[model samples]
Target: MNFTDNLAIQLKAAGFSATTDQLSQFTTYYEMLIETNKYLNLTAITDPHEVAVKHFVDSLTALDDKDLIFKEGAKLLDLGTGAGFPGIPLAIMRPDLEIVLSDSL
Candidate 1:
């Protein structure tokens, strides 16, 4: 099985359903992250499996209670969203959740 399939399995096992398009986007984003990290200090998780297990899986954990209290057309502001953490993932998981990621230099 390929990375996408493996990712699908992981997400499903975690009780999340991601469409093919969403998974594709996740794959692309993950690949771009790894490539960009070659020149920048983006993530400390270097290994591919580790990045998936630690970064990706960990993000999914926060979604446990999101659906319970999430309001329609809710606005979310992420301060100091360096490298796009919970904000980015939240945006992906909940497309309806408007997000503004802020970073200061």
Candidate 2:
């Protein structure tokens, strides 16, 4: 299956749901991440499966309390967001929330 299919399955299994467009955005983000990692040490988990589960899915776990974090104008700070981790995924998942991703590099 494609990234969208795989991601959707995983998210569903985790009691979450994502639209095709959202999954597509994730796929784009994944592509950019892999491409950028060619020069910079962005991440060690290069495999698509690992990235989906470890980076994308794992990052989303931070939003277990969707009611709290998914407010209309919620502000979130993802400190030490290595390679954008939960920040990127969170942004993708909740575009309405104001998210700040930072790292000490």
Candidate 3:
């Protein structure tokens, strides 16, 4: 399976779901990440399954708290988010939330 398929399976295993648009966005995001890594080295984990499990799925794990931490339309700042980790995935999952991603580099 490809990146998107792997990502979908990973998300499902993590008890999460993604819309087609979100999946498309994630696919584009992964493509951009891989392409950018060719020069800037955005991430050390480049393998597709590794990225799906370590990066995307790992970031998305925060969504386990659907009612407590993630208030509707809540604004969040993801400090030290290398390659837009939790922030980007959270933004993709919860469009109602306003998320900001930041890193030292």
Best by TM-score: 3
Candidates, ranked, TM-score:
3, 2, 1
Q: Give the Cα error of residue 63 in candidate 1, in Å.
A: 1.9
In candidate 1, stretches whose alpha carbon ends up further than 4 angstroms from where it belongs are 66-68
Best by lDDT: 3
- lDDT (Cα, tens digit) per residue for candidate 3, span 16-90: 989889999999999999999999978999999998889888987778966658889888999998789988988
The models' CA-based lDDT, in order, is 0.76, 0.87, 0.89
- Determine which window of 10 residues in candidate 2 has minimal summed lDDT: 62-71
Candidate 3: global Cα-lDDT?
0.89
Please write out the lDDT profile of model 1 over residues 20-45, one tens digit for every residue.
Answer: 88788778878888888899888888
Q: What's the TM for model 1?
A: 0.84
Which model is ahead, 2 or 3, in terms of TM-score? 3
Error of 1 at 48 (Å): 2.1
lDDT tens readout by residue for model 2, 1-105: 776678788888877788888999999999999999999999999888888898999888977865655667789999998899899998998888899999998
After superposition, the stretches of candidate 3 with alpha carbons farther than 4 Å from their true spots are 66-68
TM-score of each: 0.84, 0.89, 0.92
